[model samples]
Target: MPEFSDELCARLREAFQRTRYDADGVLEALGAAAHAALGRGEPELAFRVSRYAGELGTLIRLFLLGGSEPSAEVEAALAPVTIEDALAVGLLRADGESLAAGLDIRPHGDEQGEWWVISDLDSDLLGGEVPPEHVLGVGHASLSLIRATIRRPVGTLLDLGTGCGVQALHGARHARRVTATDVSARALALADATFRLNGLDVELARGEWFAPVARRRFDQIVCNPPFVVGPPRVDYTYRDSGLAGDDASALVVRQLPAFLTEGGVGQLLASWLHVDGEDWADRVTRWLPPRADAWFVQRDVADPGLYVGTWLRDAGIDPRSPEGRAKASAWLDWFADNKVQGVGFGFVTLRRAEVAHPTIVCEDLRHAFDDPLGPEAGGWLDRVAWLREHGDDLLATRFRVPATVLLETVAGPGEEGWETTIRRLHRTDGPGWQHELDELATALLAGCRGALPLSDLLELLSFAHGDSVEELQDAALPMVRELVRHGMLEAA
Candidate 1:
């Protein structure tokens, strides 16, 4: 284990700031081509670009590119922090007359600000399979959870499986207090260093799943749990829970209600198994605890073969090798025996409501959406709650079309002439939801400008169509509720 020293960390921080080794600076140094190459893990182009960036380039090579530099060059790049200081902080090691990164340390941040994260070197850096206890740094899944999380201000928040504490740092922005827990002590050690480097004060706990925070409730909980569904034997502590297929995610969902306060929210990025003759929605809804409203969005699905291939490559196993083929065969057999038809990957947002049989929205939302979905998610929760309370009085409620909503019409040239064929409503913000509209619904929605009660507009439409108000209400209430639920119209 590496030692933690405030003096060493502070010195390293000043050196990083002085060299301008941040996200934007790195991007500027690498240019578009090299940065894109780096994103694909082909760092050769990035190495070529960084050669011209002076000290920033040197640091990138030493840390990100897994390259060693001469002792004199390393000292000049990190001036005040000597090679000995870097060694003491466990960031660099002395290899003959050169210094190499002991682990990967890079700058990661959002629009709020930039911060540094430290974790075990990737498989490429290690030149072999990752150790079981390897702690992951910032990753796509972690960023996905952060983007999906509703960042409303909260009294207390919990970040489960906080490998390297990336999500905990994000939660600290809106939360008064943050608690980060991980099952691996090595992960917590890395997380401790990450928090210190970023100057964030987070309570760190070590235990599996909810064990550390048992009997405690949080105002908000965000987790990117170990949800990879596979064989019982686990290799990576960061991604596998060593349980049977999908049991880890199921366990986390079952324990959510115990840790969330009333009206509290929980955001998770997880995977679930799909079996024959079982609806995916029901499988997920059954996992939800009582008094909890859930919004489950199934982002993508893969069959047994594809899922196995994907994870095998993720674990750094080269598929063309004999060992890799054997591992793939074993996983295929396991999936077949377990009757795993497919694996679904997605995000699940749970709100502990104050009512029984809480609202559940589970559907396959596979479209690309606007980033930073926090506000949209928070708004959706509020809309759902209000709908639950005022569903009966929607006819009398006045609603205005949101500024983000756009009605698009498509016309086609037919045998006679150009004629209108399709009309659909789309939201410009978050999710960018699109819905096709019927003729009467389009006319009705056009007049929803907060100028009149919905009932009045419906009555006018009823008169135009020569239909009774009761009949119109019965026919259109479901559509109106659907529009409101999806943020097409706002209650005035």
Candidate 2:
């Protein structure tokens, strides 16, 4: 580690020893650490920083709760220790040897927010599940989602891939009981140390994904599972499941339904590959919980060479290093020859949306987590499938959609102030508005009362007007969804 980074870690230890968990001071320090990690420009650190920015929500919650306090100053005379502010900074290095040696998380803390137990990291912390040195620590994104997506009070929560018990420690606040499980006893031990240091009480289990917690179900489950594609390595247990490459994510997605309550939530940080034969949307659409609702977003996709090189670099396999070139070369060639189009990375939140219908909706959204999603995410979760369920009903209600409504194009604009369709008809200067009385002739009655669902809404318009339903729906759903998501429109 760099000398400055070492000093930075020492100051945090000193602060903790002083029990000065000052809320704002803590956040500031962690925020600075996240930036510092990014400043190094290492790939793993870059990935970790992006993740930290995303997981800031988890910190806010910790701050509000008593577990963390503002960093104090004798001058201010009111500062105290805060867990949220110290997020990444308080993180202790894992004992690579201990993790491989079989020491798992043991019980030594308050079981609520006080103490925890673990063997040294070198022996059993990661259990040979070595992450890329670049990551040095857990990615910040994993922490961000748990903080952002968790809203309601939870009774029992499970943190899969409990690398160091960060989620478990955080979950302990809202959940009556929190359990952090990992296939690596080494990881379990690290979590134990983390919880202990934070004075958090949590149950730690050592077993494969879902296997250890199979018999018990919880009110909420949060996983930062090993969701990357490809085969597993001795140390890849932290990321690669023994399952087929890419199937790793699917395995967890497939099992989530069985592990959740009728209305429970599952939040995860995962990566899925864009396979040769299909669309990523279609690939994940098949992973939906039969009775559950999901919000799946594709943030970015990197092609095969990019994907392979990325992971290779992550694992510390520097092609330029003394003995890394040949090894890394072989790995890169494998992905390219396989025609792997890309790898998709993002966060997913699933809730058991109690509806009579099974609807799957997917969108490609690359935006900040705070993308105008109001206080309650349940709305976004529900509205995603709302149109399909009630769309037909709205179409059936003659009172729902009116026939006389004008048919105007959304972007067909030559006229500055006209609807494109009107402009198209009149060849208006900037934008034009046209009264497609003839267009409404057929479409108006089809969805007149709201009987025409958005899907068919387009078909009806095409019959009556000049444009296709596909075109209209593509444009209208987004505009209307924002309205519905924000409570602007009630489901007809």
Candidate 3:
């Protein structure tokens, strides 16, 4: 772990600012193509472009491209922060006459601002398997949790297993007090450097899972846990919890409610097994605490072979190599013995609430949504609360259709002219939810402009369509509730 000190961190931050070594600066220094190539992990173009690009280019090559630079160039690039100080802080090492990065530090930013994140070097760059205690840098899973997390301001927020402190950095933006916990001391050390470099104050705790934050409750919590499912073993601290068969994810979900305040929300990324003769939804939902609302959106499902192969590759192990083949065999055997058929990867959002029957939904939402999901998550919880408040007298509530909701009519050529064959309602925002609507439901929604209560609308539809009011009420209530849950309708 890199030694963290206030003076060293401030000097590094000053060096970064002086050299213009940020996301935008790097993009401009390398141009469009090379910058995009660097993101894809192909750094040849970046190296070629940075050959003559001066101090900023030298910094990028040394830190991001995993390349060595002459001692004089490195010294000039990191001006104001001396070579001896950088080496003492474990930021660089002398490789003959050139200096190489002892740790990987890169500029990462969102709407809040740009900040530097420090972590262990990439295994690919090291040209070997990652060490058992290696800390991970920003990746897809961390970015997903960051984007999916609700950004509403809160009194307190907790980030569990905060590897490299990526999530904690974002949490600090909206939270007044942020507490981040990790089991690995190395991880905590790097996270501390990351926070200090960015000039943010965050509490760092060391312990496995929730041990560090026992008896503490936060208004919001976000975690991207070590959710890989396999035989009981720990090869890497970043991804393996040393628990058997998806229990790591299950343990986090089962224990989350205790750490959240009343009406608090927790969001996390998890993986679950799809065992033979078992419903995945039932298995996951059983982990939820009573009187809590939860939503599980499974983004992808992989068969056993694919699952094992994907994780092996993530560890920088070639699945076709002899050692990788041996590991794969044992992992596959474990899965077969446990009757595991597949694995599901997804995001879980849970809210602690006081209600008789909690709203728990698990579904496969594999389709891509262009908009950020943070608002959708908050809105879903709000809608659930609204539904619970009006459950007894739903017919008395006046509702309005949101402007984003659109009605689509599908027509086909019949024997005579074009005839409408299908009618559907599509939401243009969020996840773009769509539902097929019959004529009666269509008429009911068309009349839901907040002008009248649902009961009066149903009675008017019954009278116009020559149907019994009692039957219409029975049919429309469920549809109205579903629409409201998905943000298609709002209580006026």
Candidate 4:
């Protein structure tokens, strides 16, 4: 682990700034193509491009590309922080006359700001399998959680499995106080160093799940837990929870409400099993506790073979290798014995609320979203709460469709000229959801302009279609509720 102190961290920050070793600086040094290649785990282009990029290039080669540079060059690149101090803090190791990075430190940023993250070198860079307790750097899953997280300002935030403290860094931007916990000691140490280097104060604790924060409640919580489903064996501390099958995800979901304040929100990435002769949504929905509103959006599903192979490759094990073959066989046999047909991966958002009937939605949302989901998630919670409050008088509420909502129609040439084949309502923003509509539903929706209540619209439609008002109201209310749930309609 790296030794951390206020003075040492300040000196390192100065060195990084002097060399311009950040996301933007790196992009400038290495052209757009090479920078993107580096992101894809191919460092050949970066190695060639950064050969003449000056001090910034040297820092990039040493820290990111996993290259060894002469001691003199490394010392010059780290001007304020001396070579002795760097070596003492375990940031560098001497190989003859050249110095190599002891750990992986890469620049990471989002819309909020830029900062450096420290962790163990990836398995690809290490040229073999990583250790059991390896702390992971920023990867695809980390970035996905960062983008999917709801970032509203809150009093206190909890980052559950803060592996390298990436989520905590982002939480500090909007949260008044942040506390991060992990079961791995190495992860906690690297997380501490990461927070100190960025000049942010985050409370760090060591425990399993929510043990460290027992009896404490938070306004918001974000987690990307070790949710990989597998046999009860821990190969990696960052991906496996040593629980059989998807029990780890179930445990986290079941325990969320106890640690959240009233009306608090919790967002996390999880994996669940799709067992034989069972509905996946029902399996996941059963994990929710009472007095809580929850939403599960499954983005992808993989069959048993694909799921096993994917995780095996992620652990740096070649499927053709002897050890890999054995592990895969045993994993597949376990899946067969447990009757797991596939695995589903997605995001879960939960809100702790006291209500008679909580809004629990479990659906598959595989569409690509253009806008950030943070705002959409907050808006969904607010809209659902509003709908629940006005459930008794929903017929009297004035509703209006947002401008982003579009009515799409597909037409085909029939014997009677052009005829409508399909009618659908599409939301152009957020999740890009589409719902099929019938002629009656379309006519009723056209009347939702905020000037009249739903009951009035139903009466007008009944008079125009020559049907009873009660019959029209019963038919339109369900469609209106569905539209409101997806943000297609809003109360005036």
Candidate 5:
């Protein structure tokens, strides 16, 4: 590992900014095909297409594609800092008359802005299994968690298992104070470099899980812990916890309440095992502490064979080899012995409340979104809280449908007329959920212009349907609740 100093980091940041070596700029320079090829780990296309000796090309070849470049060209590309300064900072290594990248430094950002992240060379680039202490760069799951996180401005936020400090860095944008905790010292070192290079100040804590923050409370907590399920042994610290199947996630959920302040929220990316006889929602909800309200959205699920193969391929294991075959057999046997039906992977958003009976909503939301979902998550959780408080007085609540809600009617062919077609409400925002509309519900919703109470709508619907208001409420309450819960109808 190479040590980084503040002065050298400042010079390096200056160099990167000068080269415009950011994500958008790099994509523009590489074009679409080469960029896509690079994502698939085939750098040959990028090398062939991006054959320029300019500063940007030289920077991309040396750092991203892991190719050696003439020392003079590199020196010209980074003029102010000589090759000697680059070598001293451990970013470059001299190979005869050429220089090669000694680390993986890349630009990562979202709509907020761009910042450079420094981590160990990717295992794919290395063409081998990663070492135990390998700190990963921005991964797909990390990006998903970043997008899924509710970014309401927080007083103090804690990012547990903050590898490379990506989540902590994001926390800096919306938090007054951010604290990052990691068990691996090398990971913390990379995270420290990431914070300094980006001109961010975050408190770093070196400990496992909540040990470093014991007795301290935070308004918000985010974690992408090592929740991968495996046998008793651990291969990678960044992916596995050496615990039994799914226990790592259970442990995190159990410890969340003690460290969360009143009304605090926690967002986590985790995987849980689905046993033969247990419902996934019930099994996961049982892990939460008392009074911790949560919405568990299962994004994907895979059976034992597929899960094992997916992770094995991730570790660069060849399934045809004897060692790989034995490992797969062992994993299958473990799953069979434990009666594991499947594994569920997803995000869990939890909030602490003082209610005697807490609310827990779990659903499989493998759905599409119109944009980044951070704000939508916070809004939905706030709505859930409101629903809990106003459940008994729902009839008197005035509600309006958002503008994004659209009604679509699908008519049958030929003999069937438009009136016989099915009507549904489609939302243009998150998930794009479609709710089927019956005659009564349709009439009531079409008249919801935020002026009349729900009771009035129900009475009108009852008069039109030749039923009493009480009967209509009995039939419509569940549908109204579902619509309100999913943002089809908002309380005015």
Candidate 6:
């Protein structure tokens, strides 16, 4: 079993470290390893390995495009994963190769152990002289979100913190010309390769945040920045943005105005501080730019200790080591000293509204959601302007939506329902849902041709099913909200 494991792990690491665009050899080897690993019936190991496919795809392309790395560094990253806890996120099986079901990882815990692994991409070809790396490799969930949430069309795209340039690759497919920028030259070089590998041609630049793009605005921007708080490691380029604590996420929020064209859209995955003495919502709200309306959803939060331990593991720290424990303690104290209650990890989306005096919708919600990059995301990008202008929300919008609304579902029938969200362009506050509901009431008002009042909406439904108006209203409200939230329906 050890010999078999070593061989299989070696292939996977090679596939990960060596595969490139149109280089199907490494991927094939990986697919075999993936199958073998799953056959071992290690669910966690299988899932863990699955993340590398996207990551390696980006890295190999990056390296192919003049991105060099140290051989020793690459070899270390390629080390085998045979430990139990390390194997949990993925598995190695000979017969259990088949996934139980396709899933985008749903992350919890403050430490974000798997995210660090998924987001960072490297190769061993260079001699480790290219400086530290800051990356934003594609994860299944984020890709899914991009595909699902974007409902409207786009003309130009910009990818910040391009990492392996996966999002830039996806954006290149839709936009006429894409500009993918990163603070790291390694990332930019790889982004160049990613474009070429995908048969795309993109504009690549290196700078801190918006420095390179100064005065140049974009129609659509995609960012997967490193919002991790405190000193993630000595690797400054990849981990620290030098933001004041959790305010790192705010860098994106703060600098948004300079780069967005009027009516342009930006989607981000960020983290915010759960300040000890203040409300997190308020703290994050301050991060929004002067005028851009935005929608912020606080998906999950983690405590200091759990957060510290989690990140320690991501750095592949050995719990048995005394040094690991000391480092863990320091990280926890950092979280505590800043008065951070918990760290907020979630999505923050912004769009410059067409109208002046924009209204922002800032919300801290607990709901299930998927990636915004799918077909739905484009529509979402386009439709958000509707919320920006008409104040008609998905849950409350009253436009006569297509009789058949689109349902973006995951592969399996048992997958959870996907929630739709709206973001502000810049500065804003909640009660965002109320505005949507108001519009919905109007839509119901107009959908009924003003022939019925809100109180009697239930009665109208009764005519269709012979059920009482109260019973129909009870069932219809949830459905209407869902539709409005998803951009399938509009406010009256």
Most TM-score-accurate candidate: 4
lDDT scores of the candidates, listed in order:
0.87, 0.53, 0.92, 0.91, 0.85, 0.53
Q: Would you estimate the TM-scores of all the predictions?
A: 0.95, 0.61, 0.97, 0.97, 0.93, 0.59
Model 5, span 195-304: residue lDDT tens: 98898888999998899999999999999999888687788888889889999998898888778899999989989998998899998988988888888888888989
Off by over 4 Å in 5: 78-90, 93-97, 411-422
Clash pairs detected, candidate 5? none
Best by lDDT: 3
Off by over 4 Å in 6: 1-131, 134-152, 231-236, 354-356, 364-384, 387-492
Q: Which lDDT tens digits does candidate 2 get at residues 1-492?
A: 111133343443454434334333334534666435534543243333333432232222222111221232211221132323323333322223210112222222222433223322221123232443112233455435554456568888888878766567667777888888887755665565556555567888888789988878788888877776654443456556666556777777778767887778887777776768888888887877577777675666777666666665565555576556665566556555656677888767777656776545556656443432212355565655666555545433222322222334455446676443421122121111122223343343335344444556556566766777667655555544443443433444
- TM-score (C-alpha, index-matched) for candidate 6: 0.59
Best of the two (5, 6) by lDDT: 5
Sorting all predicted structures by lDDT, with the top scorer first, yields: 3, 4, 1, 5, 6, 2
Candidate 4 CA-lDDT value = 0.91
Q: What would the C-alpha RMSD of candidate 6 be, to one decimal place?
A: 13.7
Q: Which stretches of candidate 3 lie over 4 Å from their true place?
A: none
At residue 393, what lDDT does model 5 achieve? 93
How do the residues 8-83 of candidate 4 rate in per-residue lDDT, one tens digit apiece?
A: 9898899899999999999999999999998787999999999889999999999999899999999999888899
Please give, for residues 149-234, the per-residue lDDT of candidate 1 as tens digits: 89888999999999989999999999999999999999999998888888888999999899999999999999999898889988
The per-candidate count of clashes, in order, stands at 0, 84, 0, 0, 0, 75
Q: Write the per-residue lDDT of candidate 6 for residues 1-492, one digit (tens) a residue.
A: 012133443444444434332234333424766546634634344344544655452333223222322333333333432323123323211114221111111111111111111233222212232235534345443553344334345778888887766676566556888888888775565455444423456788899888888889998888877677875445446556766576668878888766889878788887777786788778877877666767676667878777777655444455447977887777777776777788777667787765566545455555444333234434444455555454433223334544343222223333465433431111021112222333233334345433334445655545644777666566566655444455555544
TM-score between candidate 2 and the true structure = 0.61
Model 1 clash pairs are none
